[model samples]
Target chain A: DAGITQSPRYKITETGRQVTLMCHQTWSHSYMFWYRQDLGHGLRLIYYSAAADITDKGEVPDGYVVSRSKTENFPLTLESATRSQTSVYFCARRTDYGYTFGSGTRLTVV
Target chain B: GIQVEQSPPDLILQEGANSTLRCNFSDSVNNLQWFHQNPWGQLINLFYIPSGTKQNGRLSATTVATERYSLLYISSSQTTDSGVYFCAAQTGANNLFFGTGTRLTVIP
Candidate 1:
Protein backbone atom coordinates (compact mmCIF):
# COMPACT_ATOMS: atom_id res chain seq x y z
CA ASP A 1 0.00 0.00 0.00
CA ALA A 2 0.96 3.67 -0.19
CA GLY A 3 0.80 4.17 3.55
CA ILE A 4 3.10 3.50 6.45
CA THR A 5 3.40 -0.10 7.68
CA GLN A 6 5.15 -1.82 10.57
CA SER A 7 6.17 -5.47 10.62
CA PRO A 8 5.93 -8.02 13.44
CA ARG A 9 2.82 -6.33 14.86
CA TYR A 10 3.17 -8.52 17.93
CA LYS A 11 6.46 -9.93 19.20
CA ILE A 12 7.77 -11.76 22.24
CA THR A 13 11.47 -11.86 23.03
CA GLU A 14 13.59 -13.00 25.93
CA THR A 15 15.54 -10.45 27.90
CA GLY A 16 19.05 -9.83 26.56
CA ARG A 17 18.06 -10.95 23.09
CA GLN A 18 18.35 -8.68 20.10
CA VAL A 19 15.22 -7.59 18.29
CA THR A 20 14.39 -5.25 15.46
CA LEU A 21 11.12 -3.63 14.38
CA MET A 22 10.63 -2.66 10.77
CA CYS A 23 8.91 0.43 9.42
CA HIS A 24 8.21 1.39 5.84
CA GLN A 25 6.43 4.36 4.34
CA THR A 26 5.75 4.77 0.67
CA TRP A 27 5.19 8.53 0.97
CA SER A 28 8.93 9.18 1.10
CA HIS A 29 8.53 11.61 3.95
CA SER A 30 11.62 13.55 4.92
CA TYR A 31 11.07 13.03 8.61
CA MET A 32 10.64 9.63 10.27
CA PHE A 33 10.19 9.06 14.01
CA TRP A 34 10.07 6.15 16.43
CA TYR A 35 8.13 6.33 19.67
CA ARG A 36 7.43 3.92 22.51
CA GLN A 37 4.14 3.97 24.42
CA ASP A 38 3.72 2.53 27.88
CA LEU A 39 1.29 2.80 30.76
CA GLY A 40 1.43 5.99 32.85
CA HIS A 41 3.94 7.52 30.45
CA GLY A 42 2.58 8.65 27.12
CA LEU A 43 4.40 8.31 23.85
CA ARG A 44 8.07 9.16 24.14
CA LEU A 45 10.16 9.72 21.08
CA ILE A 46 13.10 7.35 20.88
CA TYR A 47 14.74 8.62 17.69
CA TYR A 48 14.05 10.59 14.56
CA SER A 49 15.64 10.85 11.15
CA ALA A 50 15.45 13.97 9.04
CA ALA A 51 16.52 12.05 5.99
CA ALA A 52 18.57 9.09 4.95
CA ASP A 53 21.71 8.96 7.07
CA ILE A 54 20.62 11.93 9.21
CA THR A 55 19.28 10.85 12.56
CA ASP A 56 18.84 12.37 16.01
CA LYS A 57 17.77 11.13 19.43
CA GLY A 58 14.57 12.34 21.01
CA GLU A 59 13.40 12.42 24.64
CA VAL A 60 14.19 8.74 25.20
CA PRO A 61 16.82 7.10 23.01
CA ASP A 62 18.68 4.81 25.34
CA GLY A 63 18.46 1.06 24.70
CA TYR A 64 17.26 1.76 21.20
CA VAL A 65 19.07 2.14 17.88
CA VAL A 66 17.56 3.47 14.69
CA SER A 67 18.83 3.75 11.14
CA ARG A 68 17.38 5.15 7.96
CA SER A 69 19.48 3.88 5.09
CA LYS A 70 16.63 4.53 2.65
CA THR A 71 14.10 7.34 2.65
CA GLU A 72 11.26 4.86 2.57
CA ASN A 73 12.39 2.75 5.52
CA PHE A 74 13.30 3.35 9.17
CA PRO A 75 13.95 0.47 11.48
CA LEU A 76 14.48 0.40 15.26
CA THR A 77 16.66 -2.19 16.93
CA LEU A 78 17.19 -3.17 20.51
CA GLU A 79 20.72 -4.38 21.16
CA SER A 80 19.71 -6.19 24.33
CA ALA A 81 16.03 -6.27 25.07
CA THR A 82 14.95 -5.65 28.64
CA ARG A 83 11.65 -6.00 30.44
CA SER A 84 11.49 -2.24 30.73
CA GLN A 85 11.63 -1.96 26.95
CA THR A 86 8.45 -3.93 26.55
CA SER A 87 5.87 -1.61 25.09
CA VAL A 88 3.94 -0.71 21.98
CA TYR A 89 6.32 0.87 19.48
CA PHE A 90 5.00 3.22 16.85
CA CYS A 91 6.52 4.56 13.65
CA ALA A 92 5.51 7.91 12.28
CA ARG A 93 6.33 10.24 9.39
CA ARG A 94 6.03 13.99 9.46
CA THR A 95 4.58 15.92 6.58
CA ASP A 96 3.78 19.58 6.03
CA TYR A 97 0.42 19.20 7.70
CA GLY A 98 1.13 16.74 10.49
CA TYR A 99 2.10 13.11 11.00
CA THR A 100 1.09 9.66 9.77
CA PHE A 101 1.59 6.84 12.26
CA GLY A 102 1.88 3.11 11.68
CA SER A 103 -0.37 0.52 13.26
CA GLY A 104 2.28 -0.12 15.93
CA THR A 105 4.33 -3.10 17.12
CA ARG A 106 3.60 -4.59 20.51
CA LEU A 107 6.80 -5.96 22.01
CA THR A 108 6.93 -8.03 25.15
CA VAL A 109 10.21 -8.98 26.76
CA VAL A 110 10.40 -11.58 29.48
CA GLY B 1 11.24 21.65 24.90
CA ILE B 2 7.56 22.44 25.19
CA GLN B 3 5.26 20.79 27.68
CA VAL B 4 1.85 19.63 26.57
CA GLU B 5 -0.97 18.76 28.96
CA GLN B 6 -4.31 17.23 28.14
CA SER B 7 -7.34 17.46 30.34
CA PRO B 8 -9.83 14.73 31.34
CA PRO B 9 -7.30 11.90 31.27
CA ASP B 10 -10.26 9.56 31.05
CA LEU B 11 -13.80 10.13 29.85
CA ILE B 12 -16.93 8.04 29.47
CA LEU B 13 -19.88 9.04 27.31
CA GLN B 14 -23.04 7.45 26.05
CA GLU B 15 -23.65 7.18 22.37
CA GLY B 16 -25.04 10.41 20.89
CA ALA B 17 -23.61 12.41 23.77
CA ASN B 18 -21.25 15.33 23.32
CA SER B 19 -17.86 15.81 24.89
CA THR B 20 -14.98 18.24 24.78
CA LEU B 21 -11.27 17.60 25.26
CA ARG B 22 -8.72 20.26 26.05
CA CYS B 23 -4.98 20.59 25.51
CA ASN B 24 -2.66 23.18 26.99
CA PHE B 25 0.89 23.97 26.00
CA SER B 26 3.62 25.81 27.83
CA ASP B 27 4.93 27.74 24.84
CA SER B 28 4.01 29.11 21.49
CA VAL B 29 3.44 26.61 18.73
CA ASN B 30 3.54 26.77 14.96
CA ASN B 31 1.76 23.49 14.30
CA LEU B 32 -1.06 21.87 16.26
CA GLN B 33 -2.66 18.55 15.43
CA TRP B 34 -5.28 16.19 16.89
CA PHE B 35 -5.17 12.44 16.44
CA HIS B 36 -7.50 9.59 17.28
CA GLN B 37 -5.92 6.27 18.19
CA ASN B 38 -8.60 3.74 17.42
CA PRO B 39 -9.23 0.65 19.51
CA TRP B 40 -7.07 -1.35 17.14
CA GLY B 41 -4.12 0.93 17.90
CA GLN B 42 -4.19 2.78 14.62
CA LEU B 43 -3.44 6.46 14.95
CA ILE B 44 -5.63 8.40 12.62
CA ASN B 45 -5.21 12.08 11.91
CA LEU B 46 -8.26 14.06 12.87
CA PHE B 47 -7.37 17.70 12.37
CA TYR B 48 -4.35 19.90 11.79
CA ILE B 49 -5.53 23.16 13.23
CA PRO B 50 -2.75 25.54 14.15
CA SER B 51 -5.15 28.38 14.82
CA GLY B 52 -8.85 29.17 14.73
CA THR B 53 -11.43 26.43 14.51
CA LYS B 54 -12.39 23.68 12.07
CA GLN B 55 -15.21 21.19 11.95
CA ASN B 56 -15.28 17.82 10.26
CA GLY B 57 -18.56 16.02 10.47
CA ARG B 58 -19.32 15.35 14.14
CA LEU B 59 -15.81 16.38 15.20
CA SER B 60 -14.42 19.88 15.58
CA ALA B 61 -11.21 21.44 16.89
CA THR B 62 -9.96 24.89 17.78
CA THR B 63 -6.43 26.04 18.45
CA VAL B 64 -5.60 29.32 20.11
CA ALA B 65 -1.89 29.56 19.57
CA THR B 66 -1.55 32.87 21.36
CA GLU B 67 -3.44 31.51 24.35
CA ARG B 68 -1.37 28.34 24.28
CA TYR B 69 -4.26 25.90 24.25
CA SER B 70 -6.70 24.00 22.05
CA LEU B 71 -10.03 22.23 22.30
CA LEU B 72 -11.59 19.27 20.55
CA TYR B 73 -15.34 18.72 20.46
CA ILE B 74 -17.07 15.52 19.55
CA SER B 75 -20.82 15.56 19.06
CA SER B 76 -23.15 12.62 18.70
CA SER B 77 -20.43 10.24 19.71
CA GLN B 78 -20.42 6.71 18.40
CA THR B 79 -19.08 3.49 19.82
CA THR B 80 -16.38 3.57 17.17
CA ASP B 81 -15.12 6.82 18.70
CA SER B 82 -13.76 4.96 21.67
CA GLY B 83 -10.00 5.38 21.88
CA VAL B 84 -7.26 7.73 22.93
CA TYR B 85 -7.22 11.23 21.53
CA PHE B 86 -3.84 12.89 21.45
CA CYS B 87 -2.98 16.53 20.91
CA ALA B 88 0.48 17.39 19.66
CA ALA B 89 2.22 20.65 18.98
CA GLN B 90 5.29 21.74 17.04
CA THR B 91 7.05 24.63 18.66
CA GLY B 92 9.17 27.31 17.02
CA ALA B 93 12.14 24.97 17.33
CA ASN B 94 10.32 22.59 14.96
CA ASN B 95 10.07 19.66 17.33
CA LEU B 96 6.80 17.92 18.00
CA PHE B 97 5.61 17.15 21.52
CA PHE B 98 2.50 15.16 22.39
CA GLY B 99 0.31 15.28 25.45
CA THR B 100 -0.61 12.29 27.58
CA GLY B 101 -3.92 12.14 25.71
CA THR B 102 -7.58 11.80 26.69
CA ARG B 103 -8.92 8.29 26.78
CA LEU B 104 -12.55 8.26 25.71
CA THR B 105 -14.88 5.32 26.06
CA VAL B 106 -18.23 5.46 24.36
CA ILE B 107 -20.92 3.10 25.47
CA PRO B 108 -23.88 2.23 23.29
Candidate 2:
Protein backbone atom coordinates (compact mmCIF):
# COMPACT_ATOMS: atom_id res chain seq x y z
CA ASP A 1 0.00 0.00 0.00
CA ALA A 2 1.13 3.54 -0.71
CA GLY A 3 -0.37 5.20 2.36
CA ILE A 4 0.36 3.71 5.76
CA THR A 5 0.97 0.19 7.04
CA GLN A 6 1.34 -1.68 10.33
CA SER A 7 3.22 -4.93 10.63
CA PRO A 8 2.04 -8.07 12.44
CA ARG A 9 -1.66 -7.42 11.95
CA TYR A 10 -2.26 -9.75 14.87
CA LYS A 11 0.14 -10.73 17.66
CA ILE A 12 0.05 -12.94 20.73
CA THR A 13 2.76 -12.73 23.37
CA GLU A 14 3.37 -13.83 26.90
CA THR A 15 3.12 -11.43 29.77
CA GLY A 16 6.42 -9.91 30.89
CA ARG A 17 7.82 -10.29 27.39
CA GLN A 18 8.62 -7.48 25.02
CA VAL A 19 6.65 -6.71 21.87
CA THR A 20 7.27 -4.11 19.24
CA LEU A 21 4.58 -2.93 16.84
CA MET A 22 5.89 -1.49 13.64
CA CYS A 23 4.38 1.41 11.71
CA HIS A 24 5.53 2.85 8.41
CA GLN A 25 4.20 5.61 6.22
CA THR A 26 5.15 6.44 2.64
CA TRP A 27 4.00 10.04 2.73
CA SER A 28 6.82 11.22 4.97
CA HIS A 29 4.35 13.09 7.12
CA SER A 30 5.80 15.25 9.83
CA TYR A 31 3.65 13.69 12.55
CA MET A 32 2.92 10.08 13.42
CA PHE A 33 0.79 8.76 16.28
CA TRP A 34 0.21 5.54 18.19
CA TYR A 35 -3.18 4.75 19.69
CA ARG A 36 -4.85 1.88 21.47
CA GLN A 37 -8.53 1.08 21.10
CA ASP A 38 -10.46 -0.48 23.93
CA LEU A 39 -14.08 -1.37 24.61
CA GLY A 40 -15.47 1.77 26.23
CA HIS A 41 -12.62 4.25 26.02
CA GLY A 42 -12.53 4.41 22.26
CA LEU A 43 -9.07 5.28 20.98
CA ARG A 44 -6.47 6.60 23.41
CA LEU A 45 -3.21 8.11 22.31
CA ILE A 46 -0.13 6.22 23.41
CA TYR A 47 2.58 8.34 21.85
CA TYR A 48 3.29 10.70 18.97
CA SER A 49 6.31 12.04 17.14
CA ALA A 50 6.34 15.46 15.56
CA ALA A 51 9.38 14.65 13.43
CA ALA A 52 12.35 12.40 13.40
CA ASP A 53 13.77 12.21 16.93
CA ILE A 54 11.08 14.51 18.31
CA THR A 55 8.53 12.54 20.29
CA ASP A 56 6.06 13.23 23.07
CA LYS A 57 3.71 11.41 25.40
CA GLY A 58 -0.02 11.20 24.95
CA GLU A 59 -2.91 10.61 27.36
CA VAL A 60 -1.90 7.00 28.15
CA PRO A 61 1.85 6.57 27.89
CA ASP A 62 2.64 4.33 30.80
CA GLY A 63 4.22 0.91 30.07
CA TYR A 64 4.79 1.86 26.41
CA VAL A 65 7.65 3.38 24.51
CA VAL A 66 7.87 4.91 21.04
CA SER A 67 10.81 5.94 18.91
CA ARG A 68 10.99 7.70 15.59
CA SER A 69 14.44 7.27 14.12
CA LYS A 70 13.20 8.16 10.67
CA THR A 71 10.27 10.23 9.52
CA GLU A 72 8.81 7.24 7.68
CA ASN A 73 9.08 4.75 10.55
CA PHE A 74 7.51 5.06 14.00
CA PRO A 75 7.55 1.87 16.03
CA LEU A 76 5.85 1.34 19.39
CA THR A 77 7.46 -1.01 21.85
CA LEU A 78 6.20 -2.58 25.03
CA GLU A 79 9.21 -3.27 27.19
CA SER A 80 7.31 -5.68 29.39
CA ALA A 81 3.97 -6.60 27.99
CA THR A 82 1.08 -7.10 30.38
CA ARG A 83 -2.39 -8.49 29.98
CA SER A 84 -3.67 -4.97 30.52
CA GLN A 85 -1.81 -3.92 27.43
CA THR A 86 -3.79 -6.26 25.20
CA SER A 87 -5.65 -4.08 22.77
CA VAL A 88 -5.89 -3.10 19.12
CA TYR A 89 -3.18 -0.62 18.19
CA PHE A 90 -3.42 1.82 15.33
CA CYS A 91 -0.84 4.04 13.61
CA ALA A 92 -1.73 7.30 11.91
CA ARG A 93 -0.06 10.06 9.96
CA ARG A 94 -1.27 13.61 10.26
CA THR A 95 -1.93 15.19 6.89
CA ASP A 96 -2.49 18.86 6.17
CA TYR A 97 -6.16 18.44 7.02
CA GLY A 98 -6.77 15.19 8.90
CA TYR A 99 -5.07 11.87 9.43
CA THR A 100 -4.37 8.75 7.40
CA PHE A 101 -4.82 5.72 9.62
CA GLY A 102 -3.41 2.26 9.14
CA SER A 103 -5.09 -1.06 9.68
CA GLY A 104 -4.96 -1.81 13.42
CA THR A 105 -2.81 -4.48 15.02
CA ARG A 106 -4.58 -6.68 17.53
CA LEU A 107 -2.35 -7.66 20.45
CA THR A 108 -3.10 -10.28 23.06
CA VAL A 109 -0.92 -10.90 26.10
CA VAL A 110 -1.50 -14.02 28.10
CA GLY B 1 -6.99 17.91 27.42
CA ILE B 2 -10.28 18.09 25.54
CA GLN B 3 -13.33 16.11 26.54
CA VAL B 4 -15.12 14.81 23.48
CA GLU B 5 -18.64 13.49 23.89
CA GLN B 6 -20.72 11.64 21.31
CA SER B 7 -24.49 11.30 21.37
CA PRO B 8 -26.82 8.30 20.83
CA PRO B 9 -24.14 5.87 21.85
CA ASP B 10 -25.89 3.20 19.80
CA LEU B 11 -28.24 3.34 16.85
CA ILE B 12 -30.06 0.80 14.70
CA LEU B 13 -31.74 1.49 11.37
CA GLN B 14 -33.05 -0.18 8.27
CA GLU B 15 -31.57 0.24 4.84
CA GLY B 16 -32.32 3.54 3.10
CA ALA B 17 -32.87 5.31 6.41
CA ASN B 18 -31.15 8.51 7.46
CA SER B 19 -29.08 9.16 10.56
CA THR B 20 -27.29 11.93 12.38
CA LEU B 21 -24.39 11.69 14.80
CA ARG B 22 -23.17 14.51 16.98
CA CYS B 23 -19.82 15.26 18.64
CA ASN B 24 -19.16 17.94 21.23
CA PHE B 25 -15.84 19.10 22.57
CA SER B 26 -15.01 20.95 25.75
CA ASP B 27 -12.30 23.25 24.37
CA SER B 28 -11.03 24.84 21.21
CA VAL B 29 -9.64 22.45 18.62
CA ASN B 30 -7.28 22.64 15.70
CA ASN B 31 -9.19 20.03 13.77
CA LEU B 32 -12.31 17.89 13.97
CA GLN B 33 -12.47 14.55 12.14
CA TRP B 34 -15.08 11.87 11.69
CA PHE B 35 -14.11 8.25 11.06
CA HIS B 36 -15.87 5.01 10.36
CA GLN B 37 -14.45 1.79 11.68
CA ASN B 38 -15.70 -1.21 9.84
CA PRO B 39 -16.37 -4.65 11.36
CA TRP B 40 -12.80 -5.59 10.51
CA GLY B 41 -11.30 -2.67 12.46
CA GLN B 42 -10.16 -0.34 9.70
CA LEU B 43 -10.41 3.36 10.45
CA ILE B 44 -11.56 5.16 7.32
CA ASN B 45 -11.57 8.94 7.33
CA LEU B 46 -14.98 10.25 6.40
CA PHE B 47 -14.63 13.94 6.98
CA TYR B 48 -12.18 16.48 8.33
CA ILE B 49 -14.47 19.33 9.17
CA PRO B 50 -12.95 21.75 11.61
CA SER B 51 -15.59 24.33 10.79
CA GLY B 52 -18.47 24.87 8.46
CA THR B 53 -19.70 21.90 6.45
CA LYS B 54 -18.40 19.33 3.95
CA GLN B 55 -20.15 16.61 2.08
CA ASN B 56 -18.90 13.53 0.25
CA GLY B 57 -21.16 11.15 -1.54
CA ARG B 58 -23.93 10.08 0.83
CA LEU B 59 -22.34 11.57 3.92
CA SER B 60 -22.06 15.14 5.17
CA ALA B 61 -20.50 16.79 8.20
CA THR B 62 -20.72 20.17 9.89
CA THR B 63 -18.55 21.64 12.58
CA VAL B 64 -19.38 24.84 14.40
CA ALA B 65 -16.16 25.73 16.15
CA THR B 66 -17.76 28.57 18.08
CA GLU B 67 -20.34 26.12 19.38
CA ARG B 68 -17.69 23.48 19.97
CA TYR B 69 -19.75 20.80 18.29
CA SER B 70 -19.87 18.76 15.08
CA LEU B 71 -22.56 16.78 13.32
CA LEU B 72 -22.33 13.85 10.86
CA TYR B 73 -25.19 12.94 8.58
CA ILE B 74 -25.44 9.64 6.74
CA SER B 75 -28.20 9.47 4.18
CA SER B 76 -29.76 6.33 2.74
CA SER B 77 -27.94 4.03 5.03
CA GLN B 78 -26.88 0.62 3.82
CA THR B 79 -25.97 -2.66 5.40
CA THR B 80 -22.39 -1.85 4.53
CA ASP B 81 -22.68 1.11 6.87
CA SER B 82 -23.05 -1.13 9.92
CA GLY B 83 -20.04 -0.05 11.88
CA VAL B 84 -18.82 2.31 14.59
CA TYR B 85 -18.61 6.03 13.88
CA PHE B 86 -16.11 8.07 15.82
CA CYS B 87 -15.44 11.79 16.11
CA ALA B 88 -11.99 12.90 17.13
CA ALA B 89 -10.78 16.39 17.95
CA GLN B 90 -7.20 17.52 17.95
CA THR B 91 -5.72 20.65 19.46
CA GLY B 92 -2.53 22.25 18.23
CA ALA B 93 -0.77 19.45 20.00
CA ASN B 94 -0.20 16.15 18.25
CA ASN B 95 -2.59 14.00 20.23
CA LEU B 96 -6.26 13.66 19.35
CA PHE B 97 -9.05 13.27 21.89
CA PHE B 98 -11.64 10.80 20.68
CA GLY B 99 -15.23 10.46 21.72
CA THR B 100 -16.73 7.25 23.07
CA GLY B 101 -18.03 6.51 19.56
CA THR B 102 -21.51 5.76 18.23
CA ARG B 103 -22.22 2.15 17.26
CA LEU B 104 -24.51 1.98 14.28
CA THR B 105 -26.18 -1.13 12.88
CA VAL B 106 -27.94 -0.94 9.54
CA ILE B 107 -30.14 -3.89 8.78
CA PRO B 108 -30.90 -5.10 5.32
* Most DockQ-accurate candidate: 2
DockQ metric, candidate 1: 0.74
DockQ of 2: 0.89
Task: Summarize candidate 1's per-residue lDDT along B1-108 as a digit string, tens digits.
Answer: 889999999999999999999999998888899999988888899999989999999999999888999999999999999999999888765367889999999999
Per-residue lDDT, model 2, residue B34, is: 98
Query: What are the root-mean-square deviations of the candidates from the true structure over C-alphas?
Result: 1.3, 1.0
Off by over 4 Å in 2: none
Error of 2 at A32 (Å): 0.4
Q: Write the per-residue lDDT of candidate 2 for residues B6-27, one digit (tens) a residue.
A: 9989999999999999999999
Off by over 4 Å in 1: none
TM-score of chain B of each: 0.97, 0.98
Candidate lDDT values, in order: 0.92, 0.94
TM-score per prediction, in order, is: 0.96, 0.97
Q: Pick the candidate with the highest lDDT.
A: 2
- Interface-residue RMSD per candidate? 1.3, 0.8
